[model samples]
Target: MKKKIVLAYSGGLDTSVLLSWIKETYDAEVIAFCANIGQDDELKGLNAKAKKTGALKIYVDDLQEEFAKDFIFPMMQAGAIYEGQYFLGTSIARPLIAKRMVEIAKAEGATAIGHGATGKGNDQVRFELTTAALAPDLEIIAPWRDERFRTQFPGRAEMIAYCEEKKIPIQASAKKPFSMDRNLLHISYEAGILEDPWFNAGDVKYRDYFTTLSVFPEDAPDKAEYVVLDFDKGNCVAVNSKPMNPLQVMKALNKLGGKHGVGRVDMVENRFVGMKSRGVYETPGGAILHFAHRQIESLTMDREVMHLRDSLIPEYAKLVYNGFWYAPERLALQALVTESQKNVSGTVRVKLYKGGIHAAGRQSQFSLYNPHIATMEADPTKAYNQDDATGFIHLNGLRLRVNSQVNGPANIGG
Candidate 1:
């Protein structure tokens, strides 16, 4: 019996060729799996393409709802943003893809799982680490890491030529300047022309080609738009007072945010593979949700709890970025995040104008913000005692005073 390998196939130029190559090179039956996690029209015609490219069978799973509720929501609750800028759109999607792929592999009795992620990229780590965490016994086949595969198709030109020779239908051309990975959350662009860190994507010629979900800030409408997001325990549940599921909420926010050019991030980040890579992302809906979630959190979450969770943001971001979604450390951090979000139900109104998001208002039934105590005017209710601050200040400053005297006034102007 021939070995069975389940390949994560996207029906793209690389995977199109990979699907055929894996079948020929390994002398195995290749089963292609494509998870539909808000890829839009990219999922169309994948079945025909996969079979033509030599996949014995194809699994096109509609995981949009699951991806939004199960994966995206939890990460948002933890506020996991890679390197303080990236929303970790691509990073978060990998584990879910791999988890489903593993299930398909087991069900099909496949001995190995394969992916087209290059050895130099983080997806390679994300894909394999997920497989390792879930099914340690399954072999992982990465074609890009193989010397033979690299030798045969070292560049895009070679891959395009090979596709021509094989009569394989591909949408890629050598002239294409970059690669893109898209999901319901965002669309990320990298590599190719983007490899040049100084390349200005804002240049007139490249601007339209690079940006998909949003219009450039300069091109957005002059009018500012207001959006209200309702959250329950840190998960966005409605938009503009209309109750919606996670998937529906994302769709509505993406449309509103896209109109105002809300989420566009361009940054150089350290990949899990130990390299700094430039990535451009358009996460319109995600940006809005993150901002609104934080706004509500400020109103409802306790200061100490918020501070503790804020301190763990970097570590939590690192775990998600490095493909440790199923790791125990991430799970523990998630538990704390979940507990912190118990009272984080509220509505936040934000104003969007030319790619900028501004908090308009926020309110929660569990709000800790006391207007009476914080007022600068006379406290009619005497909610706060003002005369006690003298003792409070002196006591808190005792250590500073002692250190200054002992250290000879701390050397005023070195």
Candidate 2:
């Protein structure tokens, strides 16, 4: 029996061609696996296409619920926003896809696993590192990095030409000079025309190939939609008081939030490999969850704990965004994030309208909010001490005063 290979296939232009390339080059049986992480209609007819394109069999797993509850909710809890704008939407999905691909490779007794991630992008690192962590023995085949693949197809236009020569059916539309990746979590646009940082998407006369701008929200809906997220040990359990599977809740929120245009991010972020790149993302469900989770934390977490974690949020975000989801430092920080959320078990009410998700109210069995101590207009017997301020300010500013007098008044460096 010939040694077999399993590919992480998407049935897209690149993966479609990769299927044939792998089969011809290795003379091995190619088993393609697709994970349905909320990709919707994109998964339809993928099996047929894979079979026709030369795959012996195609495996498509529905991982939407697992993706939301396991991957996305943790990111939201950790406040894992990349560079404070890009939400690590695409970054989080790669590990899950690659992890499963490795599992399939093991089950099939395949000696190798292949992916369509390009050479010059972050997905290659995200996919390969995950494969390394999960199945180090299995050889990874990245076609874009391969000398033969590069020579045969050096660019997108050449890939398209090969697709046409091979009689692969490709849909034609209004010309779009950019590439987009869409999953259940979000849709990201980059490369080609979008590589230009100053190119206004709205100014362009062409239509987007993979995303629908018509779904964008601006005018407010007539009524506000209120959602309640149930968190247990930092994972969301329910939405809108309904006991739902995690993936189901994400799907529900995606529909609800997409209509209102909740999660859209555009930014220029520094890449892990040391280049700044421009990207636009749509993360409707994720934005709503993060906003609501932070609201509940504000009412539950201790002030000092919250402040300390808030200071480290950027670092935590950086770790996840940089593809260290399984790294030791990230796991250690996750332990801290989870510990702080022990009492974060509760329901948070959020109001969604227009493009923003606002926390309407929050309640927790372990809530630290108290009316007596929190109210500012209360009587003298409140939670804070008024006389303590006299010594507090002087003690805190003692070094500041001495340093200013000694080294030119109010000198910061002193």
Candidate 3:
């Protein structure tokens, strides 16, 4: 009787080879688990492919709703962005996939879990860290990191040759310059030809990678459309007074924002492994949600609270990017940031048009915008005394004035 292992199978080049390699290396029965998180039509023929690659059983879980509801929505609610650009699309999906892997491992009573993540990338960190957090007892087999496994394969060419020798059906063998991982929240491209930061986005070689505005929906009619987003305690619940599930809301927004070319970014970001990498991303749904969330925060969140929350965006982004989604520090920040949104119940209306999205109107029952205190009109019974400014300015400027007077004759004329 052989020990069993649950493998995170993508039905791609790496995982297909990994399945056979792990079986031969450990002599274990391998069950393949592929989580379907809005991959659209790419899920086709995955079961057959996995089985043909020496997998005993395949689990194709429909995790689209769960991915959006559990992972994407909370990150959006916090307005989380990595280095002011990345939507953390690939970074965010790792934990959800790893969680499922642990569940399947426990059910199958598997002693080991395997993944296809490479040694040079962030996904390796994200995947293994989540496994360590969830099921530390389960053994992890990462062939890319193993010298013995890597010695047999030098690069993609060797990987493809190995697959061919094993009669494994594959998509593309030679590595495309840009590696991409696509799901509901976004599509991310990195490495390969994109390593050159000077290459213009409009360059003919990478033109197809760019998103253009010519394909906007006809109903948009080259004009801005306004919609309201309702938030309660950091979660967006309604759009224009209509209630919605988190996944439904994201799907609706993606359709609306995609047609208008919203949320496209190209930037060079620092990776946790001490390398700077250039990546392009498309995040249609997340853009709309981010704009809407900030608008509601402006209306209800206190000034210092907003600053404090904004101050942690970089650190929060760092944690998520480095695969600390389940870490204590991230959880603590999440609690404080989310707690500040207790009074952030509101509706923020945003106008979205061809490649342009902005907040237009915002209102909330808990709004702190005081018309009387903020008004410019003259009133005899003023809540704010005008004379207070004279004393306040003098008191604050006293030290400066004294210093200047003492040094005036020597420094001023000279």
Candidate 4:
């Protein structure tokens, strides 16, 4: 009996060609698995395409809810944003896809797991590291890194020719100006024309080509849109007073945010693979959620706790971006993040307009914001005692006063 190999398939040109190559090279039966992370119509005919390309069986799992609730929510709670710009859209989705692929591989009793990620990109690391953490014994077949595969198909033209000769269908047209990766959270465009740091990705023609979830800022409506989001323990549970599941909340936000041109980001980011890559992202819903989550935190979270979490954002974001989602360090960090969200339940009203989302107002049952104490109006009974500030200020400034005395007031100018 031929060995069975489970493949992480997308029905794209690379995976299509890879399906045939794996069969021919290893003399193995190929089972293609496609994880449906809300890519809409992209997976419509994926099964037929995979079978036509020589997959003996195909698995398409609808993981949109899991993607939003499990992956996206936790990252949001942790405030994980790569380099202060990227929301880690493509990076966050890979581990889930890889985890599902590994599950299918085990169920099918496959001897090997295969993926179409190239040698130089971050996806390869994400996929392989996930497998290593989950099933280290299973052989990982990465065609782009395989010497035999590289030698046989030197470039994309040769690969396309091979696909044509083998009667396999391909979706790639002439070299695209940029590459795209889309999931429920966002759509990202990178490489090709975007490889040049100075390239204006927002040029009318290019922006239209790459944008999926949002319009250009200038094209957004003249009037602002107000939407209210409800959070339960840091996860958004409702929008505009209507309760929704995780996926529903994200979808509704996407519609509203896209109309307002909310969540468009362009940046040069450092890839885990040791390269600085330029990327443009449209994360309409995610941007709103992040903003609202922060707003809610301001009312409910303790100031010192918020500051500590803020300090850890870079590390938490790094783990997700670097393909360490299943690593012990990330798991430990998530434990702390989860604990921090215990009192983050609240409603946040957001004002959305061209390329911006602002937290208009926020309220929570556990709110630490005591307006009475914060009010400017003085209490005749001296509730806060303004006279107390004199001693408080003197105590806080003792170090400065001591330093000035020791150095002498005249020498302080030096």
Those runs of model 2 whose alpha carbons end farther than 4 Å from true positions after fitting are: 164-175, 202-214, 219-224, 379-382, 412-414
lDDT of all predictions, in order shown? 0.92, 0.80, 0.83, 0.91
* lDDT per residue (tens digit) for residues 1-414 in model 2: 986999988888889889888898999899999999877788889988899888998999988777877788777778777767877878898888888888888888899999888777888888888777778898988888999999998766877777778776555234467777777778888877778888765332433442342244544476778878887756677888788776877777787887776787768889887788988777888788778778888888899989888888999888777677777888899888888878887888888887778888888888898776667776456558778899999999999899888886863484
What TM-score against the true fold does each predicted structure earn? Answer: 0.97, 0.91, 0.90, 0.95
Q: Residue 14 error for model 3, in Å?
A: 1.5
Model 3: residues >4 Å from true position, as ranges? 172-175, 202-207, 211-221, 379-381, 394-414
Residue 4 in candidate 2 has what lDDT?
A: 90
Go through the candidates in order and give the C-alpha RMSD of each one to the true structure: 1.4, 2.7, 3.3, 2.1
Please give the distance, in angstroms, between residue 264's alpha carbon in candidate 3 and its true position after superposition: 0.4
Better of 1 and 3 by TM-score: 1
lDDT of 3 by residue, 118-167 (tens): 77788888988898989989898899999989998878888888988999
Quick one: best lDDT, which candidate? 1
Tell me which of candidates 2 and 4 scores higher on lDDT: 4
| Angstrom error at residue 314, model 3 | 1.3
Query: Which ranges of candidate 4 are over 4 A from the true structure?
Result: 379-383, 400-414
Across residues 181-290, which tens digit of lDDT does each residue of candidate 1 receive? Answer: 99999999998889999998766577677668888888889999999999999999989999999989888988989988888999999988888999999999999999
Give the lDDT of residue 240 in candidate 1: 91
In order, how many clashes per candidate?
Answer: 0, 1, 0, 0
